[model samples]
Target: MAEQPKGRLVDVELDDTIGRATPDVEHERNVAIFDLIEENVFNPAGAPENGRFKLKLSLVDKRLVFDIRNEADEPLVTHILSLTPFRKVIKDYFMICDSYYEAIRSATPQQIEAIDMGRRGIHNDGSTTLMERLKGKIDVDLDTARRLFTLICVLQWRN
Candidate 1:
């Protein structure tokens, strides 16, 4: 088996224009960020070997920007991806997340489980798409991709 890349996110910053987000969204962001920092694989294409990385995520001119840096705050790779490809999946994920959250309030256990399954499915799809988009720009494992996808979803949330 190939050796897994060993890198983690030391810090993360999100540039969001949507003001404050919902409690659920904020919680999701916090969990994702915490989990991401605790464990992750981040290898910027063409960058020299580094122990940990810092990432600044932002949406500029409808493009998703990944401003990555090394531990010493030195510049690394900056990947800019089009948001068009992620539109449909993100929309679907948000819809399913809404259903899952609402199900927790009034639905039976079975119903909540079913909705949660759907939510996970959508989340997986979004993560896969994210990996594909970052294929040549950055390398990340599926778990890292999923957590980053959650943060990206939070960025799209509006007040």
Candidate 2:
């Protein structure tokens, strides 16, 4: 059987221009980064060879950019994606997250759980959309995509 192509992220950076995110947003960003570094699949299409990579994510001119490089710090590939497809999903995710957070403070357990379920659903939608948009550019599993989507939403927080 042919071996599956796999790549891990050695380093991840989010651009400074993303601005000061809320405490909750920062926590989510940190958690996503940590989880992604711990385990991920980041095989960029047309890479020179199979190996771990470094990633710098940023928004430029309303486009989401993936700046990928090798462990040696050599540039590998860059993929730019339109933010249009993500607008609604990201907005919905934020709304649901806000509701979830607020619910935790006052809502009943069942209410909080319900809001959390909606949050997860929107998150999943964003993750699936991310994977589709990255098609032919990079390959990442659903979990990785979900974490990456969280980071993307952080970037969109101030934009």
Candidate 3:
């Protein structure tokens, strides 16, 4: 059989300068990164399939940076995406998240479920936005995009 695609990540790091996370946000960040490292398809355009890519996420001057490198820390390709496209969705997602948290504390189960549903819908929208932004720069499945989107939001943390 042909070998499986070697387009995968070995490690991922969120730059400290991007900002700190609360305990809960930290948990989500850890889960998202762990899940991403556990399974993903990260094939950056023109990168070799030697299978030793590391990813560093950070924000500089409000721009999102995807610092791709090899196991030896050799630079691969650095994609700095503008936060412009994500501004609205991220804002909406955070607002809905607030509502979801409040609903969990006081609303009925059905109410909580409804808010959570809306939260997931906004999350999906973020994922789609990310996928579109990464188009032609890197290739990732929906699940991968979703995880990355979570990390991105975590970097911009509210809680």
Q: Which pairs clash in model 1?
A: none
Error of 2 at 61 (Å): 0.6
| TM-scores of the candidates in the order shown | 0.94, 0.96, 0.91
Give residue 112's error in model 1 in angstroms: 0.3
lDDT of 2: 0.91
Candidate 3: pairs in clash: none
lDDT (0-100) at residue 106 of candidate 1?
A: 99
Residue-level lDDT of model 1, residues 10-127, one tens digit each, is: 9988886657798999999899999999888888877765568999988888888899999899888788999898999999998999898999999999999999998999899999
Among these predictions, the greatest TM-score belongs to 2
lDDT of each: 0.88, 0.91, 0.89
Q: State the lDDT of candidate 2 residue by residue for 36-126, as single tens digits.
A: 9998988888875457899999999999999999999999888899999999999899889989999999999999999999999999999
lDDT: the better of candidates 1 and 2: 2
Candidate 1, residue 14: lDDT: 88
TM-score: model 1 vs. ground truth: 0.94
Candidate 1 — which residues are off by over 4 angstroms? 1-4
* Each model's backbone clash number: 0, 0, 0
Residue 41's lDDT within candidate 2 is: 88
User: Which stretch of 10 consecutive residues in model 2 shows the poorest summed lDDT?
Assistant: 42-51
Runs of candidate 2 exceeding 4 Å displacement: none
